[model samples]
Target: MIIIDAGHGGVDPGANGHGVTEKDWTLEVSLHQYHFLRKLGIQCKVTRDRDVLLTPERRAALVKQSGAKVCISNHYNAGGGSGAEVIQSIYSKSKLAKQAADALMAAGMPVRRVFSRKGTAGDYYYMHRLTGSVETIIVEYGFLDSAIDMKKLSIRSFRLQLAEEAALAAVKYSRGVENSLYVVQSGAYYAKDKAEKLCEELKQKGYEAFVRRMN
Candidate 1:
């Protein structure tokens, strides 16, 4: 499972350009990603489902409580940049976040490096600071202040594509594909003993089996 945070909201409109508010776009993209992940059977939770402002500490708490392995915060850049940038926590390996950046690039969004904060060897965002226990990444979708970037961000279809690509990244990250093989799902049971019994049966049948706890 993953926790996604839509950066800025309500009074904190974030960066603005071309008559579009950053908060609105972040929510749209985050919500779309959440929907796509759910459709793919990937469990996910969002910090805010609507136009509400949440403090960084509050957001961090939510992510921790969700028991998500990863957290992604969505935002837009400003000042003068014309592409996408993925920022990861300093303590994180950044494997999943880089995969996400690659997926975005493949989906037609420009790539502007996946990196950590300047000077410090850790994440600069408050959410990352408080939620360092979990791998956290902040995505600057594109530069809202740049005219070139604005052209792409203004397209609704492109936003949908971004959402789809982001969700695909989450799915890939969760699965951790290392080999091509067959998978047999025995069953999904709420009780631990039932799952253990099923695994034992599969083992007796000469099949390698294990139980994965899901949220």
Candidate 2:
């Protein structure tokens, strides 16, 4: 299982830009990721499903309690800087964090860097500090303050792409693949109607079966 933190909620709106609030976007993306992963048979838990503020300590406690092996704290940057960044704990090096960041870059958000917390030994970020054994990383999707970034974020399709990429990365971190295919062929029909019939029947039986159109 994995823990996903939709950082900054309630009174904490996080970074704001182009009339969009970080809290709202974070929750939107996080929940999208949650459902996507769940559909792929990967268990996931979100810190806050709704617009409610959660202290870093409390969020960390939730991750610990969830017995999750990996965690991601989602946020948006506020500074004038543009592009995305993935930050790992000062205490550990995480290839999983890098993978997620790269996935985000592929989806659209240009990666500024994959880095760890600087200054002081041990955990620099509170959420990173308290996650215990869970390999946690902070994903700043893009600089909300940057006009270029905000313009991209304003697109609904872009946001959906970001959510989908995050879900793909999480699955990679846990299961080392986006999906484990389990194909169950119920029937084959040259007629499109018969194939659609079997597809609906499989869907009713709780199996995600589909028909393939071949040339």
Q: Which number leads on TM-score?
A: 2
Clashes in model 2: which pairs? none
Candidate 2 deviant stretches above 4 angstroms = 119-121, 177-200, 204-206, 209-215
Shift of residue 71 alpha carbon in model 2, Å: 1.0
For residues 1-215, could you state the per-residue lDDT of candidate 2 as single tens digits? 98888989999899887778999999998887787667556788999999998877788899878888888888889868998888998776677777888788878789888888765647778777777888888888888889988888877678768766766676677776644334357798899999999888978998876665543
Give all candidates' CA lDDT scores.
Answer: 0.81, 0.81
- What local lDDT score does residue 18 receive in model 2, on the 0 to 100 scale? 73
**Candidate 1, residues 1-215: lDDT per residue as tens digits?**
88889999988999988888899999999998887666445789999999998987888889878888778889898887789998887767878788889878988899888987743634577777788576778888899888888788788888778766766676667678533223468799999999999989988998767775553
Q: Model 1, poorest ten-residue lDDT window?
A: 175-184
TM-score to true structure, per model: 0.79, 0.83
The RMSD of every model to the true structure, in order and in angstroms, is: 9.3, 5.1
The CA lDDT at 29 in model 1 is 91
